[model samples]
Structures are given as structure tokens and as C-alpha cells.
Target: MIRKIGVLSISLLCLAAITSCEKDFSEVGTNVVNNDKFETGEILLDVEITPKNIESVQADNINASISDYWLGVYNNPNAEKIEASIISQLGYISNLNNKDTDTTVFNLDKVILKIPYQATSTGTTDGVTRFKLDSILGNPDVATSIQVLENETYLNTLNPSDPSKRNTFFSDDEYLGDNVLSEGGIYQLKPKATDTTFIFDRVDRSSSLTGTTTYKDTIRAINSQKLKVPFLAIPLDITKMKTLFWDKFHSGEFLSKEAFDDYFRGIKIVATGSDGLLIPLNLASSPAPSVDFHYTISEVDGTTVKDTLQKKYSFPLAGVRNSHYKMTPATNSAPANNFVVQGTAGKMAKVKILGLDLSKSELTQQFKGDFNDNLNDYDIDDNGFLSLDELQKLFNYRKNILKSNSYLLMNDASLTFYINQAINNDSNIIPQQLFLYQNKENETGGISPTQLTDAYVDPTSFGGTLKKTDDNPEKYTFRITDYISKLLSGEENTTTDPLILKVYNPTDSPVNNNVLTTSVKSYNWNPRSVTLFNGNESANGTKRAVLKISYSKEK
Candidate 1:
């Protein structure tokens, strides 16, 4: 679906007389409605997201103040990078606008776009993130709805997290081996690699930029509950850092266990703000020089944004790594998904479950009207579990939707059930989701459950041998949409179909067999006894049935 991207928001606190110049990213209690004009005058440039590297591009269809612009991405296309100038060449800013608008007059190879991974498609999000990736990859002029984060945030200096000096989870811990060293906010490295491949490191015992005032920035988890602590995670692949951190200083020395532990526990990195964060200014490599504005809010006359924040980097001169680093404005869909899901799981169960992404399709609509309504619509609730009956019906309706198949036993710390209602039609209302699993207790944040024992079925509603053949193979995706939809709708039992299995194999002629009955997934909730579907007691030939999926780190 087409998503809105790249909406710039700035801080403009109107005090009595003097204009208050707010720091690069310090929020001084400003109203979003009152600052539209101010944001227009200011052009933000991210040096890290260069014209040569931008994978998603932006285009100006109609030039009007506050009028939404279109994003036009060109990967070797004729689209040009932003051309910034100090003073408006046409005597005013209008002249500069004229030149920028004219560049697309002749041969602007405009095409609809869809955002990929990076500003440059290399996979790393280290550069500028606020820019909309959808514009770079999707439709040329579709009104975007994104709030871009500022990259000009400045702070004092940075110093590495010394275990002895700090007290947070990332500080004061001894790391070991090639295994990802730090758990929550740390990593270990050895065997120095290229700066781009592994740039800043504590593994090789090196610091690129060193001075009294450090330039450090970070992505901190506010409320701590929102944290995806690296080490404690189930999927081991979350430890994405592979750049070796071998310290040649003692490369061949005894591989002493004691020293190894110390090296892991003692590495630190002191990065600075303002410098390391590269942003593009008005499409030009250069940015206007920054001045000390000391922007302040003497008073606020309107609504007090409640249950909320005023968090920032350490007081103009201190370090704020955990929850106070500068952040790029966003909520971009694709990149956000990249951070939450890995390719393996997505390829397995997500992207294909819905003949079209019900949520995304509503926004983009390109894949609409191409599905078999007979196929139970699939969905994955926020909790991540599929509906048993709906899933079975989907396969029956589109029985040939599999290239290969396998039953998953996900190892989870917790299981939950809930109900929700559809937003639009009273007749169209469906349950939100039926099942949810947590891989880790800590990662579960703190959800409260109403009941520990709930009865439900999980075997195939329409089943046979769930094995794949060489020819009748088609790729399939697994999604929990059915479960989520059921949970949200609060329509109990009505959505669940009894578990049953049947087989008709070609052996000279068609031979019928009642292979399995009772949903296997339902048995999983028991948390105790093992369920066996295909046994000698059954009158049919042996055919296996899977009860429930386990929740564990995918290998």
C-alpha cells in the first residue's frame, strides 16, 4: 500500500518579544499548528543521506507553501538531487523555487515508487532516517504523511560506558568470545574490519574521533518496556554485528579466559553529537552554518501534552545514551518493519497470508480485488498468532498455495487471548485475534491476562498429509490474521470450525481415509499431555497432524 512519508516538523516557541532559537533537536514546548510557517523557512539537510546514495527520492509536483509535494526516486533515472543555495538567486526564495521546479520540465522519468531498505538500499539505517523511503520507491506524487526527524541535534561530548563508572544494564559487564559480547546495550568485536563495514567499535580497542568534546548520538528505548534487549532475545540472529573485533595488540598471546572476560567487560565508546550525524540540506552537500539560538519557551498558552515527555541529550554538556540521544522523526512502515522482522520469518508466514495486505492494501489498493473470497482472509494480530479454523479454510479454498510446508513449534514464555471490534461496519466487525505468545518473560513487557486456561481447537479444519510434492508446489506465507481478527471481533465459537482431516490418494483408483481429527493447536494450550493424531487406533493410513506452534528463537 502507498504510505505517507517525509513531513518536516520543527520547534517554534513564541515568547513575548525576542525570537528564541531552539537547539538542533531540543523541544521547548511548541505547538505543531503554530509552526508551519517557521518550518517552511528552514531547510534541513542530512549529510549522511547524500544524493549519490539516496535510494528513495522526493519530487515537487506543484510548488505551494504547505502544499504537499510528491516523492520521485531515481536509481540512475533522470531525476536530479536537491540543489541548495545560500541567497535566493531570483532576488527572493521564490527565485530559488523557480529553478528547482524547472529542472523537471523536459524529460522527468517519473514513476510510482515503493521504499526499499535504505536511503541507498545498502541495508544500514545509520545515515538519515527521517526521509520517506516510500517516495524513493513508490508513486511519484502521492500525498505523503510522515514526520521527518532532525539530524542537527548537538550535545556536549561522549565517553565510552566504563563498567566501573556507569550503572545502567549496558555498563559494568564482562563480555566473552565471538558470541555477541554485550546483552542490552553492548557488543564485542575482534579482528579490525573496514570503517564502513564496522565503523565505531569497542572490540578492536579503537576510537576514530577523540577530543575533549565528543560527538555522540544514540537510539535509546524510553519507558524501558519498549526495549528489544539484544542478548535476552530468542532469535539469536538479533546479534547482527559480525564485524570482527580482534585486538592484534595481543593476537597470539595465551587465550586466557580471565583476560578475555576483562576485555569484554571494559570496552567503551565516546561518540559526539552534531558531527557524526550527517544530514542533507535542501539537496545540497552543504548545510547552512548553525548558530547558538538558546531557544526557550517562556510560557505555553495551550494544551499540555500529557502522559508525555521532555527527554533530551544530557544537559547541553553531558552524555545521554540510553534514552536521551537525538532521534530522527518517523514512523516509516517498511523500515520500521525491517527493525521488527527478519527476512526469514517474513518470507515464511507474513507477506503472503493476506491475498493482499488488508491494512496496507486499503492505503495503496494496487493488489485489491485479486483474491478468492472463499479463502478465509488471513491476519496477524499485534500478539502474533493465527486463527485455527480460518487458517484451515484458507488452505482448502486455495489448496495449491504452497511450494513447501512445515509445522512450527515456537517456544514461547507466555500465551494470551483477547477480543476486539472492527472499526467500520457493524456487520463487518471481526475479532482482533485469538492467540498470542511471548518468547521471553522480560520481553513480554507487562501484559495482564484474565485467564490462564482457555479451550480452543488448533488442528487443520480441512486436512490431509501436509507434505510438499515436487510438482504441485507453490510458495505460501503463514499469517495469524485469522486469530487476530477473531480475537478482536469477540465472536466466540462462531469463527472456530471443528478440526477434521481427510485423505484421498491415487492408488490405481482414489482410496479414501479418515486420517486425523481434533485440531492439534488446541491441544497445545493444555501445557502438559502430548497429542497424537495418527495412531494404529485410527482406521486410516498414517498421516501426521500438528497441534500447535512453539515460540522460540528461529535458527
Candidate 2:
């Protein structure tokens, strides 16, 4: 009886182990098997990469999509000369009480264009405060003439041809040949002693008891605080502005927003000379860039002055702020050492897989070269040619690779791009990240760039961030396991379209929990560049771009 009980216990233990190892292979369209019957390995594939220079990009400033507008010229020794200028439409101030009987006169004071610098205070000293400007790309001390001009072109909101679509503007669009508005002079990043002080009120509130159960009105104390802020106070031509803007206010041109826009189209701020002072301007900041119309209204009692009050009407530099880039192509047509990648209508690279579109027969022939031993399970007849039954089995096997079935499973697939340190050694100027998108052809025969399927599935996993190490090469690696699996399984058709690699923009991903339906419509304002190996090097070159894939297959 004791021997029989021990035998029964052993039988039940073996049955439990077998049941736990059973797998529902129907999920992956494969045969049922145990989990420990597969072998894991990795392979490296070749890819073709080519560099393409971008002449211009769609840089429309509609709805203030682009936050940062560049101003100044950047001259790089290895790359092109980039000239950036700002053309913006001014916002109108409505509801001005011109009919007030208390104010009978309007006298124009000095008009100044205030453009605030992106700076942070470096602590106070005695009674004065000092600040350092942020992201001054080139030499900040270099002098350059900044010209403010009246924009002659009327920036339309809607497209005239289609009406349903918004008007699109390019970085290379022309907005010159207008009357100069600024008091032309050489400008530098010199913080003035007089304009450094700013005054603001600091209010304190407290409660006082009036009765046993009720409290009196809150007691308040107001104190004025003075601090220093850095900004560019470019004086405009007072005479021209009075005739053009101030006089028009009384002439009923400022009655409506449309009337004002038609009369005064916009203003253009352009930097002259190749002094290499690229100022990053954020017009959307608080106390935005504007043309201040400082004036005074005098209250008179029958031609006798009663009281005088200083007033100001500010026309903000808002609505349709466009950045026009004038880029001069690099002199060297070919950089034999490395390929260049830049932002803001700059250079990019086109990437393509070498054998992504091979037919079943071709793929079988290629598989015979390296994975011939693994094909033994499918080719049951031991024939060189794959029959219909064998082809169906091969398709199922590849499909199961993505599902991690017992038959086969794809673990990872990635592409690593090594940086050319010989050229792009400056970490400050090197782009922090790179973006890759598919250049798909639309029905209108135009190429539209879109994010890859891998990005949509999981952007975190589809990495393109710059990876650095103490001993290894600085590189950008992208994992595209799903993309490769679809291609290998014939689930997705391989097209002639190639992947475009460009500088990363925040708009490349969805914002504010919005659905990512389209590619980036705004211009890439990041003015940085990097040089990378094209992967067409010799057979033994380690820096050559290649797709590395790791997978598990039936042994």
C-alpha cells in the first residue's frame, strides 16, 4: 500500500509539470510546444544611407505654433551661412476711449520697440542686479545693425486658392523692400544703466476685528519694489510712427481690427552683417515684444490746464510672426569624411533597408546562406525549393517571431548611428536628439513626412536619443522590432519610400494628450548640427551604420 501511494504522487507531479509547460500556440499560428525548445541569437544587417541638403522648410507662424524666432546671422566654417529675420504682424488695441470729454488732447511721446532678452538674475549687488542672457549662440559682444521696417506684404490667414486650408509660408519667403522704421545704428548686447531699473508693487493684506463676531474690512499695505531686467530698447523713428500709427488712430483706421491690419500690415526686424550673433527671441513671453506709444492726455477746463496724466498705448508684436531664413549653401559639395545634419531648413539624411523588399523565393535563397539550418523544420521534403506548403509554414514561422511563440520570437531590432567626432566635436552645438520619419508620397504626388509605426506603438522604445559612454563611441540607437517583424512576415509591404533623419522637434510627438495624426507642420527652430557616418564604409569598419536584430528561433 505504501509503494502504490508513492507511485500515484509521482504520477500527479509529472502531470502538473506537463500541463504547466503546455502553450496555446494558436495565438501565434504555430504548433504547440514547450518553452525551452528554442535557441536565441542576434544578426546584423546592412542599410543604405545618403545625405540630402534642405533648401527650405515650411515655417509658417500661424497661431503662434513656433515659439522661438531666431534673429541674426550664423556663419559656420563647416556648414552654410544662416541669416534669420523676423517678420511679424502687430496686434491692435480696441476699446480706446477716444470720445472721453476729460481727455481732449493726445500728444505723442517717444516711441520705443522693447524686445526682452532671455535672461536670469545672478543675485543683487548693493542696489543693482546683474543678469546673464541665455542661449546666445554666437558672439554676443559682436555689433550688428538691426533694421526695423514696415512690412509691405499682407499676411493672409486663410489660403486664397482653397479657402478651407490655412496659408502656408516658407522660410525662404521674401518680405523686404519696405520703409525703415528704426533709428538705424549698430546694436550690441549692452545692458544700459538707465533702463536696468523696474518698479513693481508688493501688496500685503491682513484682517482686523470690528465687532465680537464680525471682522472689519481687510487692512492692506502696498509697497513699491525696484529690480533690474535686461532687454533691447530700440528707439523707432518717432516722426514716422506719429504719422503712420498715431495719426491713423484719430482717422478711424483703428476702429476695427481688420481696418488697422489693412492700413498697417506688419513690421520686419532684420539683422545686417555677418557678425555671428544669433539671438533667440520668444515674442510670446510676458511683456512681449511691442512698439510702445508713450503719450500724455491733458485735461483742460476751457483752455486752462486742469490736470496732466501720462498714458501709453502699446501695439504688441503678435499675430503671424514669421522667421525668414536666408541660407547660403556650403562651398564643399561633398564632405568625404562624414555627412552633415542640421536644423531650421538645413541638411538631413535618407535611409533605406538593403533587402527589405525581397520576394519569398529571394528571401528563401538569402535564408539558405545564413539560416539554412533553421529551415530544416519547414522543408520537410528536404527540397531546395520551398513548395506552397513550405512557404505557408515559413510565413507562419516569421509571424510567430513577433508574438514570442515557441516556434520563433523576435527579441529586439535596432539601428545604431555613430557620430563623426573628428568633425562634430563640440557637444554644445551637437543636436541632443535626432528624428526619423517616413517620406510617404501623397495622392497629389507630393512627399509627406510621417512618423514610423514603431513611434506610434511606443515612442519610448523607439529610441533616437544621443547615447554617450566613457569608453564606447557616442551614437544614436533606434529599436524598430515591430517594424522589422511586419516586413519579415509580409504583413506590411516594403515601398520605395525612404526614411528621413532630421533634427528633433517637440512637435514631432503629440502634445497636450492630443492624438498624433500628422507629422510636424511647424519649422524646426533648433539651430544645431552634427556629423555622422553614412555606413557605406569598408567591410571591417566599426562605425558603419547597420541594423542589429536579436531573435529566438526553433533549434
Candidate 3:
């Protein structure tokens, strides 16, 4: 039946049909008004990362003022032989009580070299004895010994700025003095605690009948305990050192500091014998690391000695130390999913992020953009401005405007590192903490001399110690949310530098750049853990380093 419909009824039918339409109107019609309110949603972006080899770095080029520098020797079974030595300048020693050690008055007793161990208290019963060593790598079961020799090398005499003269000293150089102060094998090395005693008063507070506390008889008890410290006490020969001191004293030549250093060159500490023990010693202790000279000027009344004058002289000194490492390529029995991470002066593990092409088309495939690849199609620019045409690209699968004039916010971003436990399972050799840095590779493919990042994430919030999980025992995670945000926020550029990893040194660093230019680096050595790469099929399939990022867009 043909029925006549009113104009209002036809308009109502057209409105209903347009509301039910599911096709995207923005593509077909240019004047379509998108009044849909913006909504918020989250997304996860995946980044592929791979590990690469890093070059060896000079250990001596570091800040010298701080005591964070290392001094020791360790021979790695699969890698290089590590050795270190210190050179110091002696301070002026005036005659004590107007008495000089010349032709008549003073008599020498003995000279002792005291080297303190790197130790810390764990709030345990033994206190200092229960303290743990900071950087005691390798097995401690084997026997090891240290030797002390007079260093005849004159460092200040050479030009200070010349790298070859001031910084190029090595382990094989013949820069030692003829006289050996303390021979090796003097102290047998072990990782056991020493006995210590403490006294404390016992206080008893109990409730009385009136609900008040009452004091009982107080008693002092002595608590004897032991702590583990890596200390070395080397006694120097009095006959040899005494002769050297007398020569300048009798000639009335208390010479200048430079002449004094040249006359009695600093001591060189050499470690040998056991391959297991190469521990770092603290050279910046409170008493100021030194050599103590014990003497007695005795006055005899009869055949028996009546007045025995006991006196001790200390030579306080401070100087730079040098580390020598003979690193051999790591020896792997079977191929694994990990690569090595080592550092010292400037050593690092270089890594490359894979499967990411920054081209617009590739970004579109991953991001699924609706616009064209050119500037006319894309909405965002280097200045972070977005056009209305760009806002249309954020439509959801339901063809709803999910985003408006808004910006993307990073919720979480992290880099996960998997350790090859099969190859590196030694507990002693594990790196305690790891650090992330910019690659800063120069034109010659080498890292710059001073390449530390000016910007750093909060240590408590980001990259730190490795985490142990039942599923992935050797996993290390780094929080890169702030770092990635900087890149997206136009604070940093990816084209300028890549990423690298190093061992984290816990010591407080000196802020002065001049000190870093001259001192030697002791800590931050090879951590032996390698990063797993993509496309490399292992027993457990392809294990790759991954950057997992979570972001949200506000409507």
C-alpha cells in the first residue's frame, strides 16, 4: 500500500539511519563534525635490544682526591691478569723536641707499613670483625701473598700533561727500587673473621607494684666476637730505611718536597702466588695511610739501662695509584644467550637496539597510524605540536575519537637483562650492581675520554643491583621511564648516542673534574654477565634483551 508520509517523519527516519551507520565518516566526508568526547587508554610498546663487545680502557685516568680508587691484584682464570700499585709524596718531617737523627742523638727501632682492609659492619655481633669486604672478587680459599718494594720511578720529574710520561706506566716496567722493604709471603691470606671484644652495661627496667619502672643492680659484661677484614701488616727493614734517612739528615739537607720524593721514592705493592685473591685495600684511612718509624733514645745510668725514651715518627703521604689489567678474551665452553659486561677506568658493554626503523612507514606499521607518512599527513612535529588532522589518527578500532588535544604519558619503562648462568655462575664473580650510560662513541669508534652523562635518574628509582627470581635467576632490570620520557620530551636525542652498561661503584664520587683527570680507578671491573640477544637461538629459544614500555594517552 502506498502511504503518504509527513516531512517530519522522513527527517526522523534519516536521523535514525545516520546514527546507526558504522562506517568511518571522516574518511568519506570532509565536513563531518567529530564531537565525540576524548577518552583515556594505555598501551605497551616493545623494543628489541642486542649486546656488543666493548674495548679496554685505561685504569689510571681517574679522579685521585677521593679514596674510592682501588689498589690490588687479581688474575682471572678466563680473562686478564689485574695488578695495581700506589705512588705517594712524603710530608715534611721536622726534628722532634729539637732533637735530630744525625751523628749523635736519635736511634732507630723499626719501620712498619700499615695497610687497612676494606671492611664494613653488618650490624652483627662482631661489629668490625663481622664486617664484609667491599670488592673481594674471586675465590678466597687459595693462598696469596703481597710484596712491597721501593718505587724508584720519578713521576713528578716528568711533564704532567704528557700521557706517555704521566699515564702510560705498566706492570712490566722496570720502575722499582733495588731495595725490597717487605718480601712476599709475609701474611697468609684468608677470608675469616677476627676476634674482637666490647663492653656494655646491662640495664633492667621492670614494672613495680605501683605500675612504675624500677632499676636493678647494673653490671658490665664483655662481649668477645670476631669480624672479617682484609688487612695487611708489612714490617719494613729498619737497617735499610734508616740508612737512607741518615744520608739526608747528616748533610743538613731536609730538602724540598720534590727532592724528598725523588730521594726516597714511594713504595710499590706487588701481589703474587695465588690466582684467587686480588682484593682492594683502603689507602685513605683516618690516621692517613703511612709508614711508622719506632725509635728509642736510651740513657744508661750504670750497666743497666736507667732512662728509656720511647718515641715514634710517622711519615704521612698521599698520591696517585695505577691499575694494570691484562684481559684475555672470555673463555666459553658452550655458546649461551648472554654477553660480557666489564668496566674500570672507562670500560663498558656496548648494546644495540634492534628491529626498530625510525622511518615514518615503519613507525606507522608498528603504531598503526591512519595518516600519510609525510609532513602533510602526520600531525606531530619536532616542537611537539599536533594539528587537528593528526588528532584524527588517534581514533580507536570502534571508530571513536579516543584522544583529543592531549599528550602521551609514560606509565612505566624498564630494560630487562638476562644473565647467562651456564657460563657465569660464580657467586664471587657476579657484579653487585650495574649502571646504564650513553654510548658516546667518537668518530674513531672509541668512547670519549670524559663521557659520563650530565643527566642521571635517581639511583633509588632506577638501575641498580641484579634481582634474583625463581624463574630467571640472573635477571637485572633497569627503570628507564625518566630516560625515555626525556627522549620523547625533546630533552635527549637517540641519534647522538646509543646505550652502554657498567658496574656500579658504591663510593661517593668527587665532583671536581680535575681530580678525575689525574687519579687511578680501582673499582668497576668486569661483571662477567652477558646480555642475551635476539635471533640467537639457545637451548631455551631466543633470549633477547627487551625494553618494555607502558604509556597512556588522555582524551
Candidate 4:
């Protein structure tokens, strides 16, 4: 009886060990799901794919009223002149009170145009930032002439049909003082360090230097104020413009701001040199851009005593001006079909997906190609729709597999974008970051500018890292798991508005807080971004943009 009991206990122990081993294997098998398969089961891993094409559009009058003060832009190295101009609107003129005294000689005093530079440079003893408009690939001390000409063009207030005429003033507008302000009379705007002790290269490449040979030290600040000095002090030849000013002022036109605007218009500064400088001024400050008129007034005091007294007048710059840019497309960008996006907010390259369709037949065909799995279990009809009954089969299969043995869930989902580097090899010109937003149109049927909250996904957090395979750089994949989930769960409000990928600049602001609601487009304060061709297109590349998904099943 004792031998029989011990044998029975041993048999029970063996059976229990076998059962435990089977359970462990079953759990392991449940955790393992085919990466490239849409197997029949209670939990199915499926993906919705959409291919898109890109379109390019130029925003109307984008450069009309910009924030930056454009010094000059040398589009073609071999070209004769730079395609940039600076115009200033005259504010209240204080010295215009004595318009009656015509005989009073208004001597040609020094006319200085004060422009404060933006803090594009940093790293000094005081740790303040400054910037200088210097050459990148030319002589630093090379003498450059800035011709101060009076703007005779009229700024129309009426709305026009043509976009080019929207600004009212054209680049080729009649600039007064062409002959009056001779080249010899114009002073050379030579760049110099405010601090004599600090030493650095005045002219150098931008921060986007790709190679080691080009980078240079940034300009240093002095006394916590390196850029405190006003940028350009080009003394205008008051002798030549004296007659124009005299005629306008004595005619009682300077009495009213509107009359002065029509009579004097504004001043235009044209830069002439081989090298160009990107000098943007802080127009939103004191000592603002202005013209000082110095004159002598003769007064007979009491008893025929003629006294010559020196009096001064000031004309502040009215806050209306813009920096114009003329860009010549490269050989690659010359193609008609090629999409292009550039500048801050000047232009935009668009990525548009056709309709979002995940029909039963469409799903089956797309899945068959993507999964590459022999779905022998699914009795799918070749011509008919993949009906609910067929889909239930897959679910039922998954359920049976997970019956008291395994578990599964989705792991990740993403959308990938591949950049065509070959399109633009110039590393310095490439955009630092890209933005995605819902491109909505306003009441005017124009693509409205995006606000800060409109950004859907950014590369810093959701964008893919640069991946290179062999010698070729691959695509940038962004995790759109939540976005895709919303679409699949029928929770996304994406029917009316589609997604658009644009070059994003975080520091973008309105030209003026007061005129923000006006028709004028905001300045492109952000960094430039690149134009990405559709990956699905054969002409650009074979790498197609895809919504990738991965999940597991319990069975």
C-alpha cells in the first residue's frame, strides 16, 4: 500500500510539470505576431495608406511690408546691381514752423540715417549680442556706396487686382536725386568694430557653415552693448535735395502729415557694391530713423540789430517701410513642374493627399501588397468587396488563438517623409525645421497665415532623425500614432481641412501689432525651409510616403 501511494504521487507531479511547460510555450507563442502579416485573429493589425503630391504657391504681396531692414541682396554674382532698396516714411517735422522766412539760409547740415542692427552676434566680455552687415565672400574694407534718393512714387491706398501692384511702389519707381546725389558725394558705409579691444572677422559666413574651413568667430559686445551703435550714418547731400525740401516746406505742404507725404514722399537708399550686407534695423525703438534739418534764422532784435541764430528741425521716419528681395531660380528650380518653397513667409511648398478612402476592396488589395503574407485562411473573393463576414473570419481566428492562452495590442504607428537632397545640394540654404498645419482659407479665399497653436507636429519632438543607408540619406519618419488612431476611430475633424507641410519659423511676428488685421501679409521672419518632392512619384524617387503600423494579437 505504501509503494502504490508513492507511485501515484510521482505520476501526479510529472503531469503537473508537463502542464506548466505547455502553458509557458503557449504564452510565448501568443506574444509573437507576424510583422508582415494580416493573419486571421480576434485582434488584427491593419494600416491605412495614402499617397500625396506636392504643389507650390506664391503668397500675394508677401514681401510688401516686412519687418527686417534689407541692406542689399546680390542675386547674380555677375550682375551689375543688387535687387534691394530701403525706403523711409517721414514722421512729424519739428523745424517746419518757420515756413514764412524764405530768405533765411538753411545751410546743408549733416543728414544722418540712423538704423539699429539686430543682435545676430553673441559672446563678448559683457555677454551681449550684436550684428554687423559684412561680406561673406568678399573684401571686408571694400568701400560700398549708398545713394540716398528721394522716393517720388505714390503709395496708392486703393486695392488693385494685380499682386505686383499691391504695394503701389515698384522697384523701378522714379527715384529723385539720381543726378543730384552724385556717387562721389555719397559716403562709404565701412564696417568697423565698436570696441577697439575686441578682435574678430567682420565679414564671414553665416552660422549655417557645413564644413570646418568656413566658420568664424561671432562679433563681441562691449559694455553690455555691442549693437548699441546705430548701423548706417550715410550723410546725405542736403545741398542737392535742398530745393525739393524748400519747395515742399514753403508751399505749406509740410503743415499736414498727409500733405507732407504727398509732397516729400520718402527717402530710398540704394546700395552699390560687389558684396552685400543683410542689415536689419530695429525700427521699434527710440532715436528711430529720422532726418535732422539744421538751419540759420536771421532776426532783427529791438533796434535794427540783425542776429543770426542756429535752429534745428527733426523729421522722424513714419513706420512704413519694407525690404525687397529678388531671387533668381537655380537651374534645377527652373523646371515648370518643380515645386519650390523659400524665404521666411514669401512662398510655400505644399503636400496634398487625395481623398481618404479605405473601402473593403481597396483595403484588401493594399494589404495584400503590403503584408506579402499568404492569407490562405481568409476566403476573399477576387472581384467582390471584403465584406463584414470576411473581416469577422479574421477576428474569429484571432479570438480562437487568444482563447485563455495569449494577449496582444498595437505597438506603434507612424508617417514617414523622405527629403530629396539631390534637389538642393547647398547646405547653407536648407531649412532648419519644417512645420505641419491645417491649410485653411479665410473669407478672401486666400490661404490664411498659420498661428502658433496650428502646428500639428514638429521634427524636434515628432520628426524622424537623419538616417543614412550606405552613401544615400534615407527618409525622415514622424510618429503619427495618435493622429492615425483618431482617423481610424472616426474622431478626427480632418474632412474639410487637409494637412500641409511648410517651412516653420518659430519667431514669426506681425509687421505691426496695430496693422496686423490689415491686408498686408506678415513678414517672413522664420528661417527658410526646403521643397520636398512626393516620395511616391517615380520622377523624384522610388521611396513612397507611407503610414506604417505595427501591432500584436492575443491568441
Per TM-score, the best of the predicted structures is 2
Q: Candidate 1 vs candidate 4: which has greater lDDT? A: 4
* Clash numbers, per candidate: 79, 1, 11, 7
- Give model 1's clash tally: 79
Better of 2 and 3 by lDDT: 2
Q: Is candidate 3 or candidate 4 better by TM-score?
A: 3
The lDDT per prediction is 0.19, 0.65, 0.46, 0.43
lDDT score of model 1?
Answer: 0.19
**Per-residue accuracy of model 3 over 390-476 as CA lDDT, tens digit each:** 322332221332223223333455666766665556544666677666655567988542323222324455655777656444767
Report residue 242 deviation for candidate 1 (angstroms). 26
TM-score, one value per model: 0.16, 0.76, 0.64, 0.54
Estimate candidate 3's alpha-carbon lDDT, on a 0 to 1 scale.
Answer: 0.46
lDDT of 1 by residue, 57-147 (tens): 1111111111111111111111111211011100001111101121111111111001111122223255422322211222223221221
TM-score quality measure for candidate 1: 0.16
Give candidates' CA RMSD values in order. Answer: 32.6, 12.7, 15.5, 15.3
